[model samples]
Target: MQIGSIQLAPGAALAPMAGFTDAACRRMAARHGAVYTVSEMVSAKALTFGDKKSAQLIANGETLAPYGVQLFGAEPETMERAAALIGGYAFDFIDINMGCPAPKITAGGAGSRLLLEPERCGAIVAAVVKESGGRPVTVKMRTGWDAQHITAAEAAKACEAAGAAAIAVHGRTREQMYTPGTVDPAAIAAVKAAVKVPVVANGDIESAQDALDLLEATGCDGVMVGRAALGDPWLFGEIRAALAGQPLPPRPTLRQKMEALRTQIYEMCEEKGEWTAMPQARSQALYYMKGLKGAAALRRACCELQHFEDVDRLIEKVYAAGNR
Candidate 1:
């Protein structure tokens, strides 16, 4: 699948998850064969105002090429400025975040709130395109504000008309949050049919079969995986293999999973410093151990650890026990 000049080998793309899709995680996903990986959403206002933290979040583009930076804001000018500022950098694509259902974002009339004002959304897309200087611009959107306002198709059309290179449709209304039974394949199909640009289907794609089912059901050009990617970076490789009609690889052994978790935590500490990385590592370590025997006890140990050595020791003990 090609988005502008960037060509992605057909498979899964990583959703721009906040507080999680950082440089190390994105690079891991890319290395595991995720066709594309987006940076966590950065504030348009923060980018324009030269907020150091927001700028840092978008700084490491070389690590994940075909990299996309997702930005959010309601104002066209701020969004335009952010596009220009970020475009001047080495990013492969710029994505407008219109799917975020967070109340803070919606209260500011950004994110999914833009769906209710398609005209304004179009204007924002147009401004970002002009600022992007030929780099591809994409939009990620939810099904709609609610069931009463299933406007993804309409908003998708407006975005395409305003120069978006692609559209990613999450198959749920803003009101659905992350609930099961909320993902409507028909809504994804509607958005795909409404535009000539590529449509990437998202939502509830937790396994290789789910990814295949989403593509077959929606006829979308690609699929994006979000929550499922947590603790499971190899999912991209699985999806890639599935799309190529290959047999699935055996699940990682407990020891292998522990090794991957140790590597990820070490890298996070190296990149973000020990103090800042530990809390996040604790959360991720727990995610990595999900479904394992004695996981609750292991998670508590991980959460209380003060240093990387402690993490390494915990992982060693867990693997030894699993082997026994």
Candidate 2:
């Protein structure tokens, strides 16, 4: 598959998730077989002013190549300026975030709120495309602000006209806020039918069956793995295998899972200081540790970890437990 000028393998891609999907997390996802990954949501205002923290959010930490950075904002000018500033970066695409439902973002008239005004959303996409030098522009958005709005089909057409290379639609309204049982696959189908660009379906996809069902149901170009991939990057491999009609890979052993978690911890440490990285790594490690024997105790120990060595100690403890 291709996103405008960028070439991509035809399979599952990692969704840009905030508080997750950072450089280390993206690496983890890629290592496990996700064909693509998008950086966490970045503030256009911060990038426009050269904010170091925001810049770090999009920095290419790996030479692995082909990752995209997602930017969020409502104003066309500021969005264009932000894209222009980062146009020379090594990323493969500049993705616009029009689907975030967080109050912090929607209150600012960014994210999913953009669906409320389809025309303006198109203009923002056009501005970013114009200022992004030759980089392809993409978008990720929800079905709409609410059931009453249900405007993803309309917004999708606008994005296509504005030159978006592809669009990803999360099948929920802002009112659902990711609540289970609220995803409407029909909405994803609507967006796909309304656009020529690739449309990726996202929302409550937990297993290979779910991914396959969404693909056959909506006929979307691709599927994005979101929260379901937390601590479990292996989902991508499983999804990829399922897409290919191949046998699913075996589930990872506990020691192997711990090692992957260790790799993630070190990656985070290299990107951020131990203090900052530990908290972030611990959270992700907890996800990895979920459902394990003595996982609760191990998680508490992870909470107090102040150094990298602590992670090793926890790994050993997990190894010795052996389901005891």
Q: Highest TM-score, which number?
A: 2
**Any idea what lDDT model 2 has?**
0.88
Worst window of 10 by summed lDDT in candidate 1: 56-65
Clashing pairs in 1: none
- lDDT for each residue of candidate 1 in 62-167, tens digit (9 for 90 to 100): 4654789899999999999998888656678899999999999999999999999988888999999999988899999999999999999999999999999999
Q: Residue 254 deviation, candidate 2, in Å?
A: 1.5
Worst 10 residues of 2 by lDDT: 315-324
- What's the residue-level lDDT of 79 in candidate 2? 96
Q: What is the TM-score of each candidate against the true structure?
A: 0.96, 0.96
Which portions of model 2 show Cα errors greater than 4 Å?
none
RMSD of each candidate relative to the true structure:
1.5, 1.4
Which residue pairs in candidate 2 have backbone atoms (N, alpha carbon, C) closer than 3 angstroms, thus clashing?
none
